[model samples]
Each structure stands twice: as structure tokens, then as C-alpha cells.
Target: MRFHVLTLFPEAFEGPVRHSMLGRAIQRGLLSVQIIDIRSYTHDIHGTADDYQFGGGHGMVLKPEPIFDAVSDTLSPYPTRDRHAFPVVLLSPQGRKLDQQLVLELATAPGLVLICGHYAGVDERVRTHLATHDISIGDYVLTGGELAAMVIIDAVSRFTPGVVGAADNVQEDSITSGLLQHPLYTRPSDFHGMTVPDVLLSGHHAQIDRWRREESLRRTLENRPDLLDSADLSLTDRAFLAGLGYVGISSLLDDGFESQE
Candidate 1:
């Protein structure tokens, strides 16, 4: 997968693109990131990419010319047939909430163009016409879209082959799995007064699998019960959750599994 990031603060990405899993993916040629400085496409000598907004705004708004030109120039090399399918994303607080499903959807694209809006935000034309996706990391606000762009890259990159070691690692991820992951323990079984669960050490694969599934459900119910509304749940899973006082268990039941309640 390839990511073309358009930002005024190109230097900000120097660290993220060079470290951790992103770094490894770039090294292995599984993923590539091209940072396009928005100012480079500006007309003036100072290369100013932002300007005071029309009809009076509190802060400067990103100019549409530089953004449009930058994106156009960055994608010029791609075959014309695939250009229409490319995702041109504008990171903003008012856009679609970033989630695992969206990340997976973006991973299917051969490449992406991420517009990191800054100042008061990009011109309305950029969002309305040029950007294919307007995405938000969460409900909260950030200083700029730089962090959000990095986040999208990391999240979407996980779905790319070889970006993460195991395909299961991405699929079974906390939010990706539609549930919080089960607890993990390593090294000495006993730590201070806490000891690892016996099922983990008993070498009983069946018992261990059951323990993991139950724990995953318990954690999700405790931390994010909203996921249960549409999470794929078997009768056994729903029964387990119901035993733990999940009231929504009354909604439906799978075939051949009568409610144990």
C-alpha cells in the first residue's frame, strides 16, 4: 500500500515514517509513504499555503489551489484508469469516524492521498470536490490533521500484507475483532502476588480457547458493551455474556441453541 500525505508541516512526519512497524514495512517494500509539502505547489515566493478565509474567519484556511495542485502532481504518475478509484482523504473532525472497518476498506486501494488540513481547516471546495473521504480519528479535536494522518496510515497499513507479522494479528486486533482482546501474560507465571491463570499453563488447548473467548467477551462488556449490538456471537458466546448480566442477550438466539437463561 502507498500513502501520499499532503501537509504544510512535512518535517513532522520524519519520525513516524521512520520508526516501528511503519519503518519495517517501508524497508521491506510492503508499504511506501510520499510526503508532499503543500507549500511546494504555491504560486508565491514565500510558498504560503494558507490564507485568510472569505466572508471573515477567525483563523487562516488552507488554500484550495495548493492542495489541489499538490494532489494532482503527486498522483500524475499513476495510470489514468486507476486514478478514479484512488482514495483522496481529508482528515477532519467533522468527517466519518475512523474505525477498523474503514481502515480495512481503505487497505483495498492500491494507494491513498491523505490531506492533512491545518489552521482553521482546508477550503470547503477541497472537502466537497477533491476529497473522496473525510475522516476523523474520534469525537475529540486535535491541533492539526498531522497526527490524524499518521494514525490513518498506521491503522490502514496493518491490513496490508506483511505490514504486520501475522494476518491473524490484524484480524484479531482489539477493535478489528469487534471486541477487546483477551489479557496476555508472558515470562514468569507468578508475578508478585498475582499468578497467571491455570488454564493458560495446563496445556489444555480446548480449555485455553474457551477461557480466551470468555475473557474477551467479559472485557468487551466491561469496556465497550456497544460492540455487542452487532458483533458476531454464537449461542455459547451470548450465553456466556448473559451469565455475566448482559441484558441485551434477550434480542436474538442462534439456531439449535436455546437460551440457557
Candidate 2:
């Protein structure tokens, strides 16, 4: 997969994407990232990318012309009447909440064009006319889109095929399956007064699987019971959760009602 990012502060990306899985993906030729300076496409002699808002605002808004020019110049080779066919994502507060599922989806795209909003934000014209989709990390606001872009890049990069050693590593990842991962223990199986679960040490694959599933349910029930409502559950899973004194449909519905209230 290829990721093209347009930003005013291109220097900010010098370190994060240069190391870890992203760096390795680049080295292995499994992924590629190109950082384009939006200011470079500015028509002004001073390379001015932002100006005071039209109707009066607290901060300057990024000019749309430069953003459009930068994206257009970068994606000029691909011919697509539907702009969304290529994925032009703008990081903004108004965007859909980005999650693990969305990350997995983006990782499969042919390429991604991420626009980093600055000052106040990109002009509405840029969002409505140039961008295909908008994504926000969470409900909270941030200082700039650069950090959000980096976070998104890192999160999605892990899902790219061959970027990680094993496909199952991410497939079973927390939130990917809409459930948290089972606990993991390494050397020093017996630590202090705590000992590793006997099923893990017993070398019984069937028993170990049973233990893991139960633990995953327990953890998710305690931390994020909302997931169970949408989780792909089996008879065995339901029975196991029930045995653990787990609350099912009742708790799930209650959470929903509380939220609406």
C-alpha cells in the first residue's frame, strides 16, 4: 500500500514513520509513504498557506487552492471520476470516529491521501470538493492534524499484509475482533506468589483454548461489555460467559438505554 500525506509541517514526520513497522515495511517494499509539503504548491511568493477567515474566526483557515493543487498534482496519474475511489481522508473533528475496523479497511486500499488540517482548519471548499472521506481519532480535539495523521498511519500500517510477521497476529488483535486479547505470560511462569494458569503449563491445547476464551470474555465483560452484543458468539462461548457469572442481553440493553437517557 502507498500513503501520500499533505501537510504544512512536513518536518514533523521525520522520526515516527522512519522506525518500527512502518520503516520495516518500507525496507521490505511492502508499503511506501510520500510526504508532500502543501506550502510548496502555494502560488504566493511567500509560500503563505493560511489566511484570516472570511466571516471572522479566532484563527486563520488554511487556503483551499494550495491543498487542492497539492492533492491534484500528487494523484494526477490516477483517473477516477469518483474522488472517494482513491480515499482522500481529511483529519478533522467532524469526521467519523476512526477505529480498528476502519484501520483494517484502509490498509487494503490501493493508496491513501491524508490531508493534515492546520491553523483553524482547511477551507470548507477543500473538504466538500477535494476530500472523499473524513476521519477523526476520537471525540476529542487536537492541536493539529499532523499528530492525528501519524497515529492513523501507524495504526493502519500494522494491518498491512507482510508488514507484520503473521497475519493472525493482527487478525486476533484487540478491537479487531471486537474483543480484547487474552492475557499473555512469558518466562518466570511462577512469579512472587502468582503462578501461571495450570492449563497453560499442562500442554493441553483443548484446555488452554477453553481457558483463553473464558478469560477473554471475563476481561471484556469487565472492561467493555458493549462488545459482546455485536461479537460473534458461539454456544460454547455463551455457556462459558454464563458460567463466569456473566450478564448478557439484559446488561447490553441496559447500557444502550442508559446512553440514550
Best by the TM-score measure: 1
Query: Candidate 2: how large is its RMSD?
Result: 4.4
Model 1: per-residue Cα lDDT at residue 131:
96
Clashing pairs in 2: none
Give per-residue lDDT, candidate 1, residue 114.
97
lDDT of 2 by residue, 11-45 (tens): 99989878987888898998888999999998879
For model 2, where is the 10-residue window of minimal lDDT?
A: 252-261
Best-fitting candidate, scored by lDDT: 1
Expressed as tens digits, the lDDT of each residue in 20-88 for candidate 1 is 999989999999999999988999999988889789959999999999998888888999978888999
What C-alpha lDDT, on a 0 to 100 scale, does residue 218 get in candidate 1? 95
TM-score of each: 0.94, 0.89
